[model samples]
Structures are given as structure tokens and as C-alpha cells.
Target: MAVTGISANRLELLSIADAVAREKNIDREIVIDAIEEAIQKGAKSRYGAHHDIRAKIDHKTGELSLTRHTTIVADDWEPEDELEEFNDSAMVRLRDALKRDPEAEIGKEYIEVLPPFEFGRVQTQMARQVVTGKVREAERANQYEEFKDRVGEIVNGTVKRVEYGNTIVDLGRGEGIMRRDQSIPREVFNVGDRVRTYIYDVRPEAKGPQVMLSRAHPGFMAKLFSQEVPEVYDGVIEIRAAARDAGSRAKMAVLSNDSSIDPVGACVGMRGSRVQAVVAELQGEKIDIIPWVDDEPTFIVNALAPAEVSKVVLDEDADRVEVVVPDDQLSLAIGRRGQNVRLASQLTGWQIDIITEAQDSERRQKEFAERTGLFQEALDVDETIAQLLVTEGFATVEDLAYVEAYEVAEIEGFDEDTAEELQTRAREFLERQATELDNKRKALGVEDGVLEIEGVTPQMAVALGEGGVKTIEDLADLATDEIRGGHEIRGGERVKLAGVLESFNLSQEAAELLILRARVAAGWIDASELPQPEPEPEPEFEDVEGEDAFAREYDDAEGEVEAVEPEGDTDEPQDA
Candidate 1:
């Protein structure tokens, strides 16, 4: 950087390059090249600006050389830039060069050694700027290359500065910023304080590569457990899933491959030392380390700790679960501000709906009463017979009408004669309902072709007619969501939109099938070309041994399962 005086000795120039290379952590050759360019620019300022000046330095002896080059060009050769005129000082015509030397040809260079001149104030300033810019660019490239591949790693750095709630950390070789939202709430750091963070993202930008850091990411918690729990780091136990509410609380599910070792007990070391280490680093944020199970219901039960679950009903198609807990355990199951259930949902990737036992009981009774009344009206049966039919899971007249006479006769107190009579009445009721629906469909101007499409029943035709889809083409043009209810963002708020066939409780797949059938009927697609439904994957079976095998045997014999007590308080995390 101190190469201002061209009169300085050649040894001093090389010494400056060596010192700069060492200070900036760059190669000596790079620094020497930058200095040579700086000297060339200074030489051009003293010599004629249009002259072709070049400078070089001896790698070993530190000697400097300045030269002016003139190249012989053909008479037809023109300048490359359209706006620029020829430079007579840098190039010579081959016709004139032949007059001076018989061997002169195009592209032949004539070099003349020049004496070095002292650097002026203006020239020294310009040369210094050029060298400084080049060095800074090199430093940025070096920093980016050193840290780009270190993403998803935990790093230690000193707090260099804080600006507007963002912490700038000096990583010794690079700098990283932890935004306000990424840092633990209420956790403050002073300058020069050592801090540990996890790198979640690293990407190149116009200014330079950015190293994004965070302490609140779910990966941060998982990484902390891997550091403290040797089983997790060694792959003996695996962290299956993790969810965090930042400084409030976090939950992670872990499983063990070796049946002899308990994952929860291993993570929660003697007297809670291992978990406490992570808790302390996280500013006393509570952690729940649930033992992960392959069964989703069992895992959800484990995730909502310190609260007992009475029953669990899952809807696999919707990826939703309805959990029923005792009246007294409702608040505990929901947690403070729904944090427990929310974290459980995140950890399990399911939408959970929690309900009390009282509510579930009331719902069951209402459904039973509704179905009993329907059977009584449709089959012309007494209240007792209708209630018995409801208890036997007879939901609709269509189901009873199509069932085998033997199945109906199997019901207690119902003989062959009673079964025959009930079946006759169910068929009559269905015929009447179909006539009414068909009349309504006709009144709505629904084409007969719409009902001709496979899977489009009379009820669906009525619904589609009311929804303004009166023809097969109209039905074929509709999206599946338009028939299977969904939410949409409107005016910055999520608004619920009712589907045309939402009352039928159609699944997404069923809705798609209906539309595909309509499209085929409309001549929009060939029936043979329709996409087939993929087969469900077979469930994996693992060989069980040790406690797992014992538990399964016990469950089979006793008709119930015993929950394993993780060796820690239910409120704290015991595993990774």
C-alpha cells in the first residue's frame, strides 16, 4: 500500500507486497500483480497517456522494469471499438515497419526500455485507490469461499456489533448476521462476548455472500442435542422430528435402534444434566423430548404430555385427528395459548382437533338419534326397532336396501320375514327419494347426460345443477377444490369458501374421479386414457425384540397398552 514513491528501492517495493500479502491473507504473487498494475498506471500519467506502457517485477530479485510497446499492424487492420480512432503511438503500419526492417510483419512488437519517474501527488492517490480496491475484492472472495459450504453447522463467534436488533458476529474468517427474529427473545449480548449460533442458510449476493444464522430454528435444537447426547451423534438413536416455539418451549421426538437403550433416558442424563445444558443455552426454554413411535396416535399422545387422552379418531385422507380428553384434562391438553397442541401438530405434520369427552359423547348421541329417526321414517319401523338398527350401524336406506337378506336376518329379534319386509320398505323409500331428486334435477335444467357420467349420482347432479354446472362440459371445466371446500386469501384475510358438493362430504380423490368421469363423457378425454389410481404402499414390518416384543405380547393378552414413562418430568425434554 505504501508504493507511492517511484524512486523507492526495488527491495522496498517487494517488501511492501510481502507485508500486504501476509496481512490480508492473500498470495504474494497476487499482491505483486496488483502493485505492477498500480505502477503501470502511474507510468502512463507521466508518459504520454496514449503510449502503451507495461510494468513487471522480478519474482526473486525484486527488480522493476518499465517498457513501451509498439505493435506492427496490417494496413487494413482497424480499431475494435467503433467509436474509437486509431492510436498512432501504440501501433505502427506494416508498410512503414517494412521500410525500417525487412523482417517486420503484422503483430510484431517493438519494445523500448524507459526510465522510472517520481510519482506525483495526483498519480500516487489514483494508484493507491486501485490497489486498495483490488485488495478489498480479493478479501471478499476469500471470505465467501471459506464459509459457503459451512451451512447447517454450529459456529462460535464474537459479537462484533449490534444494529437495530440485528447482531453482527465476527467468525474469525468471516462475518455473519443473526436477525432479530432469529435470536432468542430477551437474550442480549454485549460486544466481544462469545456466542454460538447455527447456520441455516448461505447464499451469494451482489455485495458478497451472506451467512444467515439463527438460534430459534428447529435444527438448532436438534444440533444442540446431538452435541450433548452421544447416542444421537453416534447414530444409535435418531431424532425423528422437532418443532420449536422459540424461547417459549420446544418438542422433539427421538427413536432408538437398539432396544436395550432407552433414547429418552439417554438424552436426559443423570439428574437432568444433559437436558439442562441445552435448556441453559436456550435461556431456560422448556423442552419436551417425547419418545417417537411409528403410530401417529401414540406419538400425538406422547407429544401432549402431562395430559391424559381418552380416545383418538383419525381421518387419514384429510391428515386430521380428533382427540378426546377428559373434562379436567382439556386445558392441560391444549396447553397455555394452545402451544402444546400447536407444537404437536408441527411435529407430526397433522391438523389436530382437540375435544372433551363430554363433547364427544354428546356428538355420538346426536348422530345416533339422527340415524334412528331416519330409519324409522324410511323403513316404517317402531322406535325400538329403529334404535336397534342404528346400534347395528345401519346408516342409510341405500345400505339396507342393497345388503344381503342373510345379513339383515342376522340382526337379533329380526326373522326372515321381518328382514324381507324391511328390505322392501327400504327399496321403496330409496325409489321415492330418487324420484324427488330427479324431479329437482330436471327442474334445475340439468341435462340427462350429466347424470349419465359414471360417479355422478342424482344427488350430485342436483348439487351441480344448483351450482350452475348443468352439463358435462361445465362439470369437466370445474376444479376439484370447487367441489371439495377450501380456504382462500381475500383482502389479506383467509375466507372459507363452500364447495358445491361439500354437503356430501366428498374426499379430494372422489371429487377428482367425478370430474374425470365428466370430462370423459364430454368427449374431452378418452376413457382408456384416464389416469389410474396408484396403489397404496404396503406397511413396513420390523422385527421386534426385547421390551418392544414384550410390550406387544402384553398388549395382545391384556387388550390395552401401557404408556412408557420417559425417565424425566413430563414437562421437560428427555430425548433428542
Candidate 2:
């Protein structure tokens, strides 16, 4: 039967298609595809046809209709693999194309068209379900496409629902997923609560494009600053650098090209309104907006917030810094868990060693006295003599100890024995110092360095540079192919970069420490990078424990005082 009562349904479909297009922000074709797909599924259920069918609408007439397509074939042609074969002259070009593929024949009937029947109880119910589900899905996909490119952008969304610590944000376009990891710690949300988030990631997957929104991203800070300070948006105040421990604290360094505007004051706002708004959004996450300075000392001072720095000594060649603080503020400068100076070190891009005023003063005084010799009371002759001997060409204790008596007689006023005495004293000092240095190395937990070898490539060097595989975790992370080349130690010739070992040229022990430190830094292993120590040589079975007097070994044949063995019925060794 030809269906005629579809004009109202056609109008309804058009209305739905338009409304859904507006809802999902997509064009009308997507909705039409969804509708056609739903109709096909409905037709399958309605007719119980041999194969699936399709439906379409008259584009010009605005009339709803259906069409079914199936393979036309004659009764004689054979399709080798199938139980049915419809290859004959009556069939169209099916047999002609099939000659290229013997598995299919021209006359094979793939499907047969069927007339449209009135949609009844079961078909109408099924058609409505399929249409509704597909339309909603298409809408979600449209929303995904609409928002995917806007990753890293800021948007306000209302909390629509929460499940498993994930908040579904209704952005009016669609629901954006704010996962547990994306949320600021301790911040809570309820239905209809509007919150701002940074669109961080958008993953197009099977169900839909997953919209990943975050409140803890670094861009969130930038966005908030942009919102608060007009200068940032207008390009007057430049945010030179920003570092964040999300949910805890954030430190940002800003520079002002416009001298008329104070960057810090602008960001802080009058009476602290601007920064306060950000703080409220972060649930009281502290923010420090500091003025960036070019001079390292000045920069370091600003980097260490809430604590005053007295001095900063930068060692560019060594990439290290010494931060001097007043004795009273030493503890405060380091902060709880060393957070203050640690963050300052990161911001300043140097390895920072903090020294209090007392330590710095003592060091300066000692160096001054050594250089001037103005004060003799505090100057030990041993240190002075050590310096003198070093300057006089007796460089090391080993060299001094091996010097002949004849050579010791060369220096004026110093006889052979006196020189010998000097050598003895120098030797003793070096020995004690060597022992102390060993203890220090042990205390520091020395590590290994990289080695240079043939066939080393840049890729291998980068791999070693990034990870020092002293531990099992590092090894576990490597792919099978990477492990094939074997691993390099941090201080080895090929692996350790050139400049890192320069400081150790005058002091080779320093190089050892550097390699070990690099290994530790790479997390290749704990301080002890080696595997468990090899089992100590098993101690020989000694006669000390439970030693039977008669069983004690002795030179009996030589007539020495030796215990004689009673060999008869005692627990005698098995006969070999």
C-alpha cells in the first residue's frame, strides 16, 4: 500500500531537523542523515525484509517517502560461494562485472525492493526510538566539533551533573567533562553552579569528541589575569614568566613596558580587588605577582617572596647560585619544605645554595686572613706550610713522600731531616684529608657518569640525558628496541656532556660527585645505583665453632702438638 498520511510527519521532521540543527549548532544535512539512518533501522524492524532497506525525502516537493534497493538477477547465473545463484541474460550488467571477480555473478540477486506499508504499532514505537537516539548522538557530535578547536580557551559553564568525581558542565552548546584531575583540589560544585574553566583537551572518540575542561591548568591563571588586568589584554603589561603549584600557590613575574603603569599594582588592583577575584575562584589559592628584574640579585630577591634576601652570587659557568640571607631570616627564607627558595631557584634558573649571614661572614673572614696574613694567631702553620709546599712544586703528598733525602736538602735553611719532617707532615695531612674526603663522598652517595664510545648517536645521547637508568623503573620504561643497545652510565665519557666535567679537571674527585649527582637526579636509581652487593665469599668452614678437640687439624706427622683423630665409630667422613 502507498502511504499518504505523512504530510504532518514531514512537517514534524523538518521542524525537528531545524531545531536539532540549532541545538547542536550544526547544519541540516547531519540531522537528515540521522533521520535517514533511523528510518533504515525502522524499516528493517517493520518489514522483517531479507536485507536492510532505506528511506528518503523529496528534496523539492518536501514530501516524505521510502525506497528499497536490491540486486536484480536472472535464475541461471551462479555465484560460486553462495547457495543462491542468479546469473542469466535477463539480469543487467551484474554478470559482466562479475567475470572479473568469479566469486560474484552478474545475475546474483543481492536484494529485492519492497512496497512501503503503513507504519503500525511496533514499527512506530521503534522508529521513534531510533530517531530520538540518533538525533541526540548527532547533536553531541556537532557540539564536539563546535568546541574542539577552542581548546585552551576560557568559557563559563553551569554544573549540570556529577558522577564519579566528574562534573558535566552544560556550556549551553553541550556538556563538557571536567574530570577529577582537572578540578582544583577542595573546590566543589553543584547543579546550576556556573564556573569558568580552560578548555584543555578535546579527544574525538567513538561516542563523541570528549571535551576536557580544567580549572587547574596554567592557562587558567593567564586567563584569569587577562580578565582582571586590562593592561594584560591591551598588551601594556607583559607576563614574563609564570609558575604554578596548582591548588596551592602560583608565582608570576610581570614586566611593564608602559612605565606609567606599575605592573604589580595594576594586577593587584586598588584595594586588592583584581587579585582577590582570582583567589576566590581558586578557592583561596595564593597568588604572588612580582616585578621581574634583569639583574639576577634583584630577580632572586623578588623570586623569594615573603623572605628578604641579603645577597645573590651567581656562577654562570657552573650554573649555580649562592643566596645569602640574614641569620634571622635563614629558616624563613628556606620556608617549610624549602618551598620558598626552591621556587626561587626554579624561577631564577640556577641551582641555589642558601647561606646564612653567619656562614658567609665566617668564610669571608677566613679567605681575607689567608690572602693578607694580617692575623697569625688563627693561621695554622700546617695550612700555611701546605700552601707554601704546594707553591714550591711539591704538589701532592705522594710526591712529597717519594722525594729522596738528597732532594730535600736543596731548599735553603731546610736540611735533609727538616725537609724529611716537612714531607712526613705533608704526607700525614694528605692522608687524613683523603680519609675525610672519602667519608664525605660516602655521605653524599656518589653516582656514575656517562661514557663516550663509538657509534654513539644524538638520539642515544638525548635518551641518556633525559633518563639516568640507575633504577628498575627506568629500565622498565624503556622499549624493547631501546634496551637492545644497552644503557650508559651518567659520568661515562660519551654520555656526560663536555661542560659538566670542567669543574673536576683540577679536582678529579669533583667529577665523580657530578656523575653520581646526575644519576641521582635522573632517578635511575637511589644513591646506591648498583644492584645488591655480590655475596661475600663464603667463609671457609673453620674449626672454631663446636670444635672437637680430637677433630682439630694439626701437623701430626711432624710431631707437633696436634690433636689425634679417632677414626673408628665417631661421626667419621663418608669414604670416598
Candidate 3:
């Protein structure tokens, strides 16, 4: 198995390729290709470069063969001028090819076996480098293919290196990285320590496959629970949603397919054995297992466990929930640093506002007073009648005027006749108010363009006219927040131009809709243009450098203010 005049053994070449393939976890064929390419390079160095030379190795016998190949051209294949342009290295005349092979025909190839050449130290070193480079490239391709489909699965690896708070893990077949922010709070790893992480992402880069692993990800806990709980793994129970404040606490919602088996109880295991195993792996992060309910309010109540909810008012249009807890349970519902409600919000996919029963009652009282005053002033009704209307949840004159007679009659202390009379008074009062506002709007020189816009009531038009927003274009120029809450100026003074629509008690959502319609009317935006919700920015954890290395991973107040309708009638109108 040795080549003449060469110090390296041919059999040893195959052995080396096998060893490298095993160590690098690449295919043996890839290593063989590298070896053949390196041999071809060495042979080319010995022979002339102009000759077409190739090398092949026997898969089992480890025998190497080197040969030169030339294309056979027919003697009468082309005109004399065309033949003259053909290069000698690429083609041989049929008559000349027949000397080597009497049976040579047109389009056939002439092969000449060449004796193996001796390799010098420099040439051998160069060949080794070529083989190494090719094998390294093959290794990278193998690594990328192996882990690409494994994203979102948990992988166990040993810490191979740590640089600048980033840990590189040797996963046996591939390497992964856990970035500083992706690691759990206050968690640390030294070289050779076993680490378990979630394969969050896998990206192909110039260097190699970048396997992004995470310990802080919510999916990581889900995977851990799947491993510990056989019910979860077997699909008897499904994890509907999960939220984690890594190393601090987590919440998971599970649903059971079998009615007899409780999802929460299955996840909790017998006497907390299963969840405890997951907790130990997560460094003692507290977990709350909740049964998943189809009803949103019930699901939300389950998410905010251990906190008794007195009432839940859902604003479905805005994807928000106003939760009222018993006065003593308010602090528990909110949790320390607002963690409980924040996790519940994340799990439920709804923004939540937690208030005590006392606070809710007070708010309701204030709303009742505001509506009572509006009815008293608008319909010239007494305080008793106004209070009765407010108690029945008639928040606007429009609601009373347009509601079914039976709906109003169902109110206490009101018959069908009284309901009809109240509706008449409500409609008449609204008509007179609209006429007065129209007169004021005309006197203020409000343009017809502003008046024609939908959502701009006559009263709103007068307010806009007073604020110098006399045209649709002027109204369209305002920002969404500006229309919702007028911005404050220097020295605590506020600009009132944007407050024109706010005076009508429009929700932020309604105000934005009004401005959008105005923009459409002014030809600034098309009617087909729809508003898209902005993506929430990822929270940045503050790195606290100390013995603990504590990282604060959650924000105190994470909920965004959504557009909520006014709870009472619009405030009493000012003199036009």
C-alpha cells in the first residue's frame, strides 16, 4: 500500500481520513474527497500543469491512481482552419489516438497512467494543509445541517469557553452560544460544566452555524416541563401558554384532553414531584401551574391565581381587562413589583389593570355623579330622575335616545310610559344642543370641510373652531397622542388645540379614528389605509456587577395604555 519514492504510506492516508472524519463528526466521503483533491494537487506539482490530471482512491483497498486524460478528435471532424485553432492539451487527432488505442473513435477519451512521484517536505506540508482546509469546510456544512431543524429543542452541552460574558457550549456534534442577556439572572458557568439550554435560533454565517441558545426564554421552561411530566410529553395535557421571569418566577397554562385528569394536577405531579424537578433545573424559579379555560375572563382569573377577583370588566375592542379584587387582595393580585399581574397579562395576551373593590366603587360613584349632572343640565330633569338614569347605566344622551323602550323600562322606578317620555326629552334636548352648537360653529367660521368629516359632532366642530382648527387639514395635522391628551408646554401650560376632540369624551381609539377620517377627507391619507399596531420593544436588563451579578429582567409597569371609552356621559357642555 506504499507509493514508490514517497515517505507517506497509501494505507495510512485512508486511516488518517477515517480518524479525522470520526473526530470531526463529518461524513467519510467528505474526508475521502479532501484526500483525493490533495493528491491531485501534489500530482499536478510534479507533472506539467497544462495536462488534465485527476486522482482517485479505492474506497476499501486504499489504492491510489493518477492518470492523464485527452479528448479524441476525429481526423475529418472539422475544416483545416478550425483544426488549427484547437489546443493540443485538450484534444488529440483520431490517427494519433489510434496509436495508443487501435479501437479509439471520435468523442472517446485517451487515458495514460503515470507513475506516482516522490513528495518533498514542503510539498507534503502543503498537501496536508489543503486536506485540513477542505475537511474544515465540510465540518461546518455538517454542523449547520444537523442543528438547523433542531431549533426550539432543548440541548445539553458542556461549557467549552467563556468570553466577555458569552459562553460557548460544545454540544458533541456542534457548538452553540448563550449570549449574556439570554442566560438566566445571576447564573454562571465554568468550563466543563454541564449546561442545558433552549435552541432559540440557528443562523448560517460566514464563519459557521451560529446556534443561539437561551436559558431565560419562556420556551425553555416549557421544554423542561415536557421532559419531567409524562402527561405533557404524551399529549395527555397540552401547554397552552407560558411566561417566565427567569430565575424568579414563571407561569404556565395547561389544558387536559382527558376530562378526568386535571391538567394542573398532572403538571404538578404527585405531591409536586414533577414540577419540583423542573424547578431544580431552573435554579428554583417558582412556577404556577394553571388550568387553561376557553373563556378569557376565567382564564385570566386562573392566570392571576391566589388572588380572589371580585369582578372583571373586559374591553374586548381594546384587548384590555379591568380587574377588581377585594380590598385586602389588591396587593396580592398586583404582586411584588407588579410581577403577578405582568406575568398574567403576558400569559393571557391581554393588558390588565388591577384595582381594589373600594377603588372600583369610588370610581363608579364619581362616574354616576358626572352622568347625573349631565342629565340634569341637558334634559332639565331633576336629580332623582337623573340619578335613576345613571343607575341604569345610560352613559350618554345618544344611548337613552336610541335604546329600545323595553331596555329603559326595565330600569327600576321607570315604566314603559316613563321610558317613552324620557326618550322624547332626550332626543329633543339633543336637537336643541346640536342647533346651539351649529350656530356657534357657524359664528366661529368653522369650514364646511371640518363639519363634513365623520366622528366630528357639531359640539366637537365648535370646540375645534375655538381652537383654530377650522379645517380638516388642521385636524389631520395632529398626532394621535396629542388628540388623546393635549401635551403640556413650558411652565406647565398646556396647548388646547389637540384637546378639541378630547372634550367630547372620546376614547383614545375613537380620537385616533376621528383624526384618521379627517386625514382621509383632506386627501392626506386614503380610506383604505389602516393603522397597524407597533411591535413592542424587547426589554433591556440592567447588568448589576457584584458578587451576585443580579440582572433585573422585567419592567415594573409593562402594560401600555389602551383606548378606553369614557365611563360616564360627556361632561356638561360649556356655553357656545
Candidate 4:
């Protein structure tokens, strides 16, 4: 056995590993891992050994051992340990240098380690290599164990260096890397910056454990909010949603079940204290907290705070929204070249088209006329009666979905031929609309949460977009008529919305209403568009005046048809 450096008595593999652990303040297992790694490296460096080799270290006590195992079947002349050539007895003390115990069975193999002896210069160099390798392996193992479970959790680390906007953090066990992409843009970082970052992941790489960290992760912002606002952690205030622009701005929607505890106020704290602290963490990022709403239009109003929405045109079939503000408030509504609307879109997941009142009004009058179901051609009595027939539920746009088109035809106001025409048109229009939607779906690459189904007029798309329904996927289930109907119900004396529904392929408003309506019908939404009905009609002459009484009643009963009926028809009050 040849040796270099200090001698280790009874230095089993485990003992050396333990000593390294105690000395380096690393785990003992790390040292064992290091030693085993080193042994394999050393055995490989030998290059000519035909025997199996192994290395191990004890856990409870520091001990290190290495051995070369030789198969008894063909115990060839190749030396089992590091040295390949067998030397004479003087050059190789086989019995003593190799600890050979008396388990003397010929066919059984033996594993032995080199005993204490002098190593030549080359051999000493080899010894240093093994120890260095073991140390490096220990460092990696230690680093891995320390940071593995910390992924996705916040960690405090000092900025060791910054290069090309990328900050390298020195987490005590090993270095953590924070790349430029992970950092909030325009936020300056310098050496010794005590930053709190979220550990996104830990991956094992060639040199050591790779610690991936991020400052812009939403979780980081959420955690900061939790720390700054005591109510957040206690569940008094809940963060329902957050939309970020990295270093520039963030919009969060919050809700508090406790009516007395205002979510926004709780976040803002006294004199803007709590929110300020969170802002400081984000390096002065602007944050807007808006209250969440059960209704989308109302929610959007809050989402785009500080701007008054004069009108919201929902494109139900397209799941988009068009919002109109007065001309004077356009910039405020858009917010610094549309930053507000942009973030609002991200927050609400919708495409919004904003217009001034004039533009909105003009669009409604001209381009969106189809939405009203009417046109330049004047409507006469027959058309009105025809519409009334439709309102009574004989509309067969999608005939398979309804019963009794014929019964509707038999009603006092309608004839069979007209009913048949109505049914056919209804069916064909539905078929056309279906084909249109299918085509739109294909063209838009319509995927859930991504592309929207087509058929939205620009104005309607804007309205629904403003309302938070952004895609055809958003509109397909909706009753396309509801949005353009503008919360108005169809059945009434002059309430015939025929011109509106039939005139514009456009609804009275815009495509956004149709888009959202479609989605509503498809059951993608939980909202309802049915209007509250008007008061019921009352029966005539419930109260009788006493003057003429039954004497007039007897005369009326006898000559009722000729005298009373004609006069009653002329005198009776009726809807104009």
C-alpha cells in the first residue's frame, strides 16, 4: 500500500466522510457521497484495473474505505487495486498492504484496500485529485439538500454581483441565479442588495444545484401583500385577482366577505401605509386595487377606476364590449395612451373597444342598425302582427329546438302560409348563423381562453370586450338577440323590435352584445339576460257605479248585442 499526505488509522470510507462533514459544517452524507464519487474517479484514473471497485463511508462515525474487488473465477495477473502491474514481494507487500482476512475459500472473491506506505510523486498527485473531487461533490450535495424544498417559497439572499442586468445571488449554501428575464424591468439592482425573491425551481446541474429565482412572480407580490397587510393572512381581506405590468403597474381585485371591512381600505391602510410598503418592495410599482363585482359591467367600471363609463354596449354573441365615454373624458378613460384599458383587459381577460359618446351614438345609428331588427323600409300592421306571432314563441329560427309553429299559425292574428314562411326563414337564419360561427371559430383558432368566435361588429366586440367576454368561445352559448336588445323584452303593443332584430346583421347596439349573448346561451356564463316583466293587465269594470243600476241592466240584457255592445266598443278605453 502506498500513501501520500497524512496517515488515517482505521480510516474507513465513512470516517473520512464524517470528518469532512464536521470540518465543513455540511451533512455527513454529503461527505460520504463525495468519497464514493472520488473513489470511482480514482479507480477510473488507474485505467488498467480489471477488478470491480467500490468506496463507502460510515454515517454515525467518520470513517472512509476503498477497495478493489476481484472475481475468483478468473483472478488474472492484472493487479486488483490502483496499480495494474504486479511487483515482486519487496515492491508489493501483498499480504500486509492489502488487509486480507482469513475467510479462506478459494472460489470466493476478496475486496482489499491499500495500507499505509509511501507514495511516489505521481501517486501523491493522484491522492490530491481524489480528495479535491470528494470535496467538490460534498459541496454540491450540501447545496442540493439545502435548497430543494425551498422552490416556490420566498428566500432572502444578498446580491453578490450583477452582470448585464442579471443579478447573481449568494445564498449561503450555493449561488442562486436571478437572470434578467426573471427581474422586473427597469428596476436597478446592485451588489449587496438584500432582495427577497421567490425560488421558482431548483435543478441539479453540472457544477452545483441550480437555484432559479424570480422577483416578478405573482406569488412574490401576493406574499408581500400578505406581509404588509395583517388582514390578508387572517383571511379578513382576500385577493381575488391580480394583473401586473412587471415593474410599472399592477391591478388587483379584492373582496372582503365582512361588509364592514372594506377590502380596498384594508389594503391601503392608514395614510396609505400598508400598500406603500408593498410598493417599496416592488420598487415603487404603482398598484390599483378595485373591488370585485358580481356583475361584469359594474365590475368593469371598477376595473377601470377614475373613469366614468357613459354607456356600455355588450356584444353578447361575440363576448366583447364597447364602452363609450364623453369626448372630454376619453384620455382619462384610456389612461396614458391606453395603459388603463390594457391592464383592465389583462385583468378581466377581455378585449375592449372604447369610443367617445358621439362615435358610439353614430355607430349605433348607422352600422349597428341590423342589431335593432329593422331597416329604412317602414313597417306596417302585418309586419307588426308577424312580430307579435314570433313573440308568442312560434319563432322557428332553430325549429328543432321548439314545439308548435302550427299552433302559433292558428292564432287569430296569423295564417298558415305566413307561419310556414316564418318557420323556414327562422330555420335558414339559424343555419346561416351556425355556419358563420363555425367558420369564425376556425379562422380565429378558437381555443378556450384564447381566440374568440367571430361575428362581432367592431362596436359590439368593443362592448362585450369592455364587459369582459373576449372570444367566440365566450359568445357561442348566448342568445344572440339579448345583447342587441339592450335589456329590453320583445312583447309589447308598439314594442315590436322587428326592425331592430331584422335590419342590421348588427344588433341595435354592436357585435359585442351578440358575442356575449352567444356565450351565455352556450352555458359558459352564469349570467341571465331576461328582463323583468311589466305589470299585468287589469280586467275592465270591476267597480260598478250605483246610479242607473239594474233597470239599465235589464234593458241592456234584453237588447245587449245591438245597443250595448256597439256603444261599449266605441266608449271602451284601449291601448293605442
Listing every candidate in turn, what is its Cα RMSD in Å to the true structure after a full C-alpha superposition? 6.4, 23.0, 12.7, 18.5
Cα lDDT computed for each candidate against the true fold:
0.85, 0.63, 0.81, 0.61
- Which digits, one per residue and each the tens of the lDDT, describe model 1 over residues 1-576? 334334466888888889988999977888888888888898898898999999999878788889999999999887788897778999999999999999999999999998867778877897898888888778788888888888878999999999999999999888999999999999998999999999999877868778899999999989999999999999999999999999989998989999999888888888899999999989988888888887666677778776777666666667777788899999988899999899989999988889998998999899889989999999888999999887876777777898899898999999999999999999999999999999999999999999998888899999999999898899999898899889999999999988898898777888998898888888899898777878999987677433212122123322333333323333334532
Per-residue lDDT of 106-151 in model 4, one digit per residue for the tens?
3455567843334455544665677767677667877888889888
Rank ordering of all candidates by lDDT, starting from the highest: 1, 3, 2, 4
Off by over 4 Å in 3: 1-22, 28-134, 405-421, 432-576
In the range 1-576, model 3's lDDT, one tens digit per residue, is 123532246678778879998998888888988888887777777776667788888878788888888888877666478445565776899999888788988888778988868766656776789888998888889989999999989999999999999999999888999999999888989999999999999999989889999999999999998998888999999999999888998888888899999777777878888888988988999998887766566677778877876666676656888888899998889999999999999999999999898998999889889999999987888999999888776788888999899999988888999999989999998899888999999999898888888777787788888878887888999876666566667678875544655655566787788889888898988988947658999987464332212122222122222222223332110100
Candidate no. 2 TM-score: 0.55
Q: Once all C-alphas are superposed, what RMSD does model 4 give against the true structure?
A: 18.5
By lDDT, the best candidate is 1
lDDT of 4 at 330: 87
Judged by lDDT relative to the true structure, which candidate is superior, 2 or 3?
A: 3
Clashes per model (N, Cα, C within 3 A): 2, 21, 0, 83
The predicted structure with the larger lDDT, 1 or 2, is 1
Task: Name the runs in model 1 displaced over 4 angstroms.
Answer: 1-21, 26-138, 446-457, 471-493, 504-532, 538-576
Candidate ranking under TM-score, highest first, comes to 1, 3, 4, 2
Better of 1 and 3 by lDDT: 1
TM-score of 4: 0.57
